[model samples]
Target: MSTTEIKRIKSKVKTNSKYVSLITWIVMIYFVFSVVMLIRAAFLPEEAFTATPGLIFWQITIPINAGFSFNINIPMEVLPNYEPERFQAKAAFITYHSIYLLTYTSVLLYGIRQLTYILWSITDGHTPFTINNSVRLRNIAFAAIGNALLAGHIATICISIFVTQIFSMNILNISFSGLIIGSLLLVISQIFRYGAYLQEQYDTTL
Candidate 1:
C-alpha cells in the first residue's frame, strides 16, 4: 500500500476504533452494574417483587428517569403464588441471565476488539493483506457461529427444566443473523488468506 493510502486508513480507523472502544467500556460498566444488581435483587424483600394478573413471571422495577426504568424478572414463578420453592427457582433463573450477559458481552467485545486491531494494522506499516487479519476475521467468524449455536439453548435448558417439572410448553429459538453473517465471514476470511498469500508472492517477486 502507498503511504497516502495507509495514512488514510489509519485516520479513518482511529476515529471509528475510538468509538468502538468507548462502547466496549460502556458495556463493561453496564455488565458489572447488572451483575451486582442481579445478585442483590435475587435476595430482595417480597415487597420488591411484583406479579401482574395472568403474568407468568415476577418483576421488580427501579426508576431511572421519569419515564425510564430498570426491570428484572424472576422466571417460572407464576402470579399470585409466591411459593417458597420459587425463591430457589429465582436464584437459578438469575444464574442463567448472568451467564447470558457475560457470554454476549464477551463475544461482542472480542469481535469488535479484533475488528479494531484489523483496522489499525494498516497504520502500523503493514499492508491490508496480512495473515494476521485473516486469522482475526476467522476468530470473529467462529465466535459468531458458536454464539449462534449456543444462543437460546442455555436459557431454554434452564427454563425448560422448570417448565417440564412444573408447567408444560415447547421452546425453540435460533439466531439466523449470526449463522448467516458468520458463514459469510468465514468465506471472507478465506479470501483474505488467499489475498495475503498473493501479496506475499508479489512482495517476493519485487
Candidate 2:
C-alpha cells in the first residue's frame, strides 16, 4: 500500500481502538457484576432470586441445532422449579459459571489489548507488516480457539461433580463462530508473517 493509504488505515484504526477500549471496560464492569450476582446466589439463593424474580439462571444442554441450544424464555412461574434448595448445588453452580466467565472474559480482554497494541504501533508509524504484529495475531487466534473449544467442557466438568443434584448453571456455550474466526485469524497472521519477511528483505536490500 502507498504511504498515504497506510496512514489513512492507521488513523482509522486509532479512532476505532478507542471505541474498542470503551467496550472492553464495559464488559469488565459486566463481568464484575455477574460475579457478584453469582456469589450472592451461592450464599443467599432466595435473595438473589428475589432481586431477579422472573428469571432463573439455569441451562438446558439439549442443543436445538449443532452446538447451539434453544433460547425460548420460560414462564416466571417455572422459576421456582429450577431453584436448588441445597447450598451445595447452588455453590457448585456458582463455581461452574465463575470459571467459564473468567476464562471467556480473560480471552476477550487479552485479544482486544493485543489488537490495540497493534493499532497503536501502526499509528506510531511502525509498519503493520512486522514480526511482532504477526506473533500478536497468532497469539490472539490460539487463545480464542482454545476458549471456544474448551471453556464449555471445563465448566461442565466442574459442575458435573454435583451431577446427581441439579445445579443452576448456564447452558454450555460451544461456539462455532469463535472457532471459525480464530482459524481465519490464524491464516491472516501467516500472511502477515510472510509480509514481514518481504518487508525485512526490502529493508536489507535498501
Candidate 3:
C-alpha cells in the first residue's frame, strides 16, 4: 500500500483506539455498578423476592425439513409453591450473575488492554510491524480464545446450576465466535511477524 493509505489506516486505528479506551472505562464503571447492585440484591428483604420463580422454561426444537419441526417447551417450576426456596433461589441467581459479571469484565478488560497496546504502537510513529507488536497481537489472540473458553465454561456451570438446582432441567449453549476471531488474529500475528522479519532485513541492508 501507498504511504497515504498507510497513514489513513493508522489514523483510523488511532481513532478506534480512543473509542476502545472509552469503552474500557465505561465497562469498568459498569462492572463496579453491577457488583454494588449484586451486593444490594443479596441483602434485599425476603418480601422483595416474592415474584420470582426458581425455574426456567426451555423451548427445544428439532427440524425434520425446511418447514417441519418438533418443538417442546419444558416448564420446570419446581419451587412454584415453596416461597422460602424461591427466595433462596433468587439469592443464588444474584450470586451467579455476580460471578458471570466478574469473569466477563476481567476478560474484556484484558482484551481491551491488549488492543490499546496495538493501537498505541500504531500511532507512535514506530514501524507498525515489529517483533513486539507481533507478540502483542499473538497475546491478544490467545487471550480471545481463553476468554471464549472461560465464558463458555462459566455459562455452562451457571446453566447447570439453574437447571439442576432450580428447576431440575438440563440445557447447554456455547458460542465459538471468539475462537474464530482469535484464529484470524493468530493469522494476522504471523503476518506481522513476517513483516517484521522483512523490515529487519531491509534495515540491515541499509
Candidate 4:
C-alpha cells in the first residue's frame, strides 16, 4: 500500500479505538446507574417510585427499547362498579402481566448473550482469529433482534403503567421520568452500535 493509504489506515484504527473506549465507558456508567436505581428501589417505600413489577422489568431491560407513551381513555361506566367485574379485570391484569414478564425475561437473557458475543468480537485483537466475519454480523443481528423485543415489551409495559396511573388519578410526573430514562437509554444504545460499526470499518481497512 502507498504511504498515504497506510496513514489513512492508521487514522481509522485510532478513531475506532477511541470509539470503542468511549462506548465501553458509557456502558459502565449505565450499569452503575442501574445499580443505583436498584438500590434506591430496595431502600425506598412503595410510594416513592411506584413502579410495578412490569415497570421494573421494563427498567431492568433497557436493551429492548420497551418504553413508550400510551393513551388511556376509559369511561367510568365501562369499568363497572360491581365487585365481580372488578375481580375479572384484576384477573385479566394479572394474566397479562404474567405473560409479558415471562416473555421479557427470556428476551433479556437472549439479549445479554448477544451483547456478550458482540463485545467479544470487538475486543478480539490482531491474533489469528478462527471466527469468520459472519460471526460478528450474526452477533449484531442477534443484538438487534433483542433490541426489537425489548422495544415491544417496553411499549406494552409503559402503556399499562400509564393506564393504571390515569385510572388512579395520580400525578403526571412519572411520564417525564419515563421520557428522560428512555431518551438516555436510546442514546447509549446508539453509541454502542456506532462504536461497533466504527470498529468493523477499521478492521476491514486493516
Per-candidate TM-scores read 0.75, 0.72, 0.69, 0.39
* Top TM-score hit: 1
* RMSD vs true structure, all candidates: 4.7, 8.5, 10.0, 12.9
Ranking according to lDDT, highest score first: 1, 2, 3, 4
Tens-digit per-residue lDDT, 1-206, candidate 4: 89687557556655665666666566556555544444443444433322222312311111112563211222222222233222233332333334433443444444454444444444453311224333443444444454444434443444345333323322222334334544554555565556557767777895
Candidate 1 local lDDT, residue 64: 41
Candidate 3, RMSD to the unseen true structure:
10.0
lDDT of 1 by residue, 161-197 (tens): 6423444333435578998999999999999999999
Considering summed lDDT, which 10 consecutive residues are worst modelled in model 4? 55-64
- Candidate 3 collision pairs: none
Task: Report the C-alpha lDDT of model 3 over 1-206, residue by residue, as the tens digit.
Answer: 89999889888988998999999999889778667666666566644433333346333333335776433332332222344443354444464555557666777788788878878888987787899989988988887887666665554455446533543322223337987888899999999999999989988895
Model 3, 69: alpha-carbon shift in Å?
38
Give the whole-model CA lDDT for all candidates, comma-separated: 0.68, 0.67, 0.65, 0.41
Best by lDDT: 1
Off by over 4 Å in 3: 1-7, 50-87, 158-172
Which ranges of candidate 1 are over 4 A from the true structure?
Answer: 51-69, 72-89, 162-172
Which portions of model 2 show Cα errors greater than 4 Å? 1-3, 45-89, 162-173
- Evaluation by lDDT, superior candidate among 1 and 4: 1
lDDT of candidate 4 at residue 158, scale 0 to 100: 44
Candidate 3 lDDT (Cα, whole model)?
0.65
